[model samples]
Target: MLEGLMLGLQSIVEPQHFLVLLIGVFVGFIGGALPGVSGTMLIIIVLPITYGMEPISAFILLTTIYVACVFSGMITAILFRTPGTPESVATVFDGYPMTQQGKAGQALGIAVLSSATGGMVGAIFLIFLAPVLATFALQFSAPEYFALAILGLTVVATLSGGDLIRGVIGVTIGLFIATIGMDPLSGIPRFTFESAPLLSGVDFIPILAGLFAVSEVLRRSRDDHSIKDTFQKFKTKIFDFPIIKKILTTLTRSSLLGSAIGVLPGVGATTAAMLSYSEAVRWSKHPEKFGKGAPEGIAAPESANNSAAVSAMVPLLSLGLPGGATTAVILGAFVMHGLQPGPMLFTNEPQLVYTIIISMLVINLLMIIFAKPFITIFSKIMNIPYSVMGPVILLLCVIGTFAVRNSMFDVWIMLLFGIIGFYFDRIKFPLATIILGVVLGPIAEEEFRRGLLMAGGDLSIFINRPISATLLGFALLALTLPLLKKVFSKKTQPPPVSG
Candidate 1:
């Protein structure tokens, strides 16, 4: 293991490789710090740009950006209440509160420290346990995958921003939107209304752009209030080992949760972050303090998000299964470079696997080294006027969605969703739930069909397979636990007073 890692490090130590890693991190920081843009979008846009580059160099650069964006999300979340990515939504709960309390620097420091630890833990797991985990991952069948998606969908109830009903509504809307394109099993289209573009289903980029970025821009546009604090500086450094240790503990828990979820066939980073945050809240001594400036709040989701980012690579590299949309994109990148990723990847191209792992570690170290001094500078992005910044963000959204297929239709779809997103925001709907539905809906549909076919359309098939049964059992627990808690709480509580 050590020898392989050393060989990998040697490969990445080349000047050109170092340059690729540096460029990726730099781009990632900007992408993540900018509101309305995500690391995934940046990577998708840039994938074509890396067409002629060596496979290793391209993957190294892309993964560096992927990892860096996870960390840089804290910048916007802490300085402004706006989250740069859905994964950082939990960060805004506590991070912005710290900023409001004049502890922006301290919050930023903690976020960076926690994200590094989370990312490092994830990288370590990828390096050491990818083989073992891949074996377990292969055990999943269609029913099991369906159950996993169901489990993820249930998290919407917990992450409904304290409004369980609204969360359910948001999830329903998301599911409906996901159904807009062609039907998965049948050739007949469902809700496209005869538009050719709609036959492909709603594009993830445009929907996500509308839901997250454009909606946020509109929401921020309505707010005329200015921040009261002239940004304050704290002497908080990344090397504060005591704080780092505490942050590590929190990140470790979240990372483990994320990795486990990512190893599952269909669930992805968004669900991992949401579930981790919910678990963090459940485990906290003061659960009510969560979403009200609790440090653990930020740490949990950041850790989970980064961990899921890495673990998603595992299935793609080892099982020839893309764990999520981003990993699917990465898989395409690998194939473009004439490399096939699967179990044979390890034995056939051990050096390539190790190089990817080592590059992750090195890129993280470089990101931390570079992000420290600029923490204060990046936090100042909060001061930019909403009017000036919002249009630029919208423009980027337009460019990103259009760049995906170079289709004017996608751009129009983005604008249409932007309006839908604006209304969803006004109605207190959760965008994360919608994105999860879109990402996971097809998986659920495919698996549900496959499982039924295997059982000859017998409903008992869900219980016939042991793995399927166990997964369904877990899904039931996920669904019922919240209701059980509420029921028990109500039983123990006094009646409300009349107004």
Candidate 2:
């Protein structure tokens, strides 16, 4: 291990590799700070560029970009209400609120710090514990995956913000949307209505951009107030040591949880962030402060998502399994270079594997250093008036949505979802619930069917496996706790007197 680490250090310090690493990080920062351009998109765009490069250099470039992009998404989410990527969706709950309260600097500081810390922790795991964690992840079958999806969906209760019924309705709507494409098991279209484009299903990037970016623009357009006027005297500090110290517990807990979740195949940073946010709320001393600009709220999701983004590489490197879309793209890069990931790769190419892991540590530290100055610039965005900023944001959203698949159909989808998001916002429905359902619905549906097939159509398979049973039990508990609390509160209250 020490030899491998030393070899990795030697390889990364080479001028060519070091230069590519910086360039990759810079490109990723720009891409992820833009609405609708996710880390997956950035990597896909850069795929052809890596064709002639050496395998280690290509891996270093792509992985560095991947790590940096996840952290950069929070910049937009904190300064504006827009999530640069879906993984930053949870950040918007508290991050934007903090911006509104003129604490943009503080929010960005916490986000950057938490992201760096979480990323380092994940890199350490990737270095020393990748094999062990990957082995444990191998234990997950269809039933366990299904149960995990169910557990992720149960976060709707916490996301509802006291409107459980409305939250359920929102999630139902999202699930319906998710079912529009061809069924994974039957290979038949379910809700395409015979439209060819619908057969591909709604792209998540467009939906996410429309919901957060375009909807925010529409909301701001209706108001005559200027952000600068609203908070004329407000000044923000780059760091708040006291606040960081206060939220350290949440940060540590979320980082660990996110890394653990990231080891599971097909579960991405977005799910990790949502689960971390929900758990932070569950364990918080003042749960009511969540969604209201609490420091812990910003810390939890940012830390978790960044950590998850890094640790997600574990499955790909160790088990030859792509943990999420971004890692799937990385796997493609590996294949293009005539290298395959798995146990054999470790023994066959230990130097290259360790180089990638060690490069990630350096990339993460560089991100913090590179992003510190930008936080000040990003925070200044809040001072822009709605009239000027709204159109620019909408235009960016349109370009980003169109760029994804180069389809006008996706642009229309973005516009439609933008309006839908506006209405949902007006009605005070929880958008997080809908997003959770949309993201997790397909995973749950596919895994559930696969689990049933494995069990000869017996429903007991979900309960028969210990891991699956535990995850399902947790999901049920999460779903029922809110209702039980409401019922008990009502039961304990005295009857109202007649008027």
The prediction achieving the highest lDDT against the true structure is: 2
Candidate 2 local lDDT, 292-331, one digit each (tens)? 9999998999999988888888867875556555675576
The TM-score values for the models, in the order shown, are 0.72, 0.61
Error of 2 at 61 (Å): 9.0
Give the least accurate 10-residue stretch of model 1, judged by summed lDDT: 225-234
User: Which regions of candidate 2 are displaced past 4 Å?
Assistant: 1-132, 229-360, 375-389, 489-499
Clashing pairs in 2: none
lDDT of 2 at 276: 96
Best by TM-score: 1
Residue 217's C-alpha lDDT in candidate 2?
69
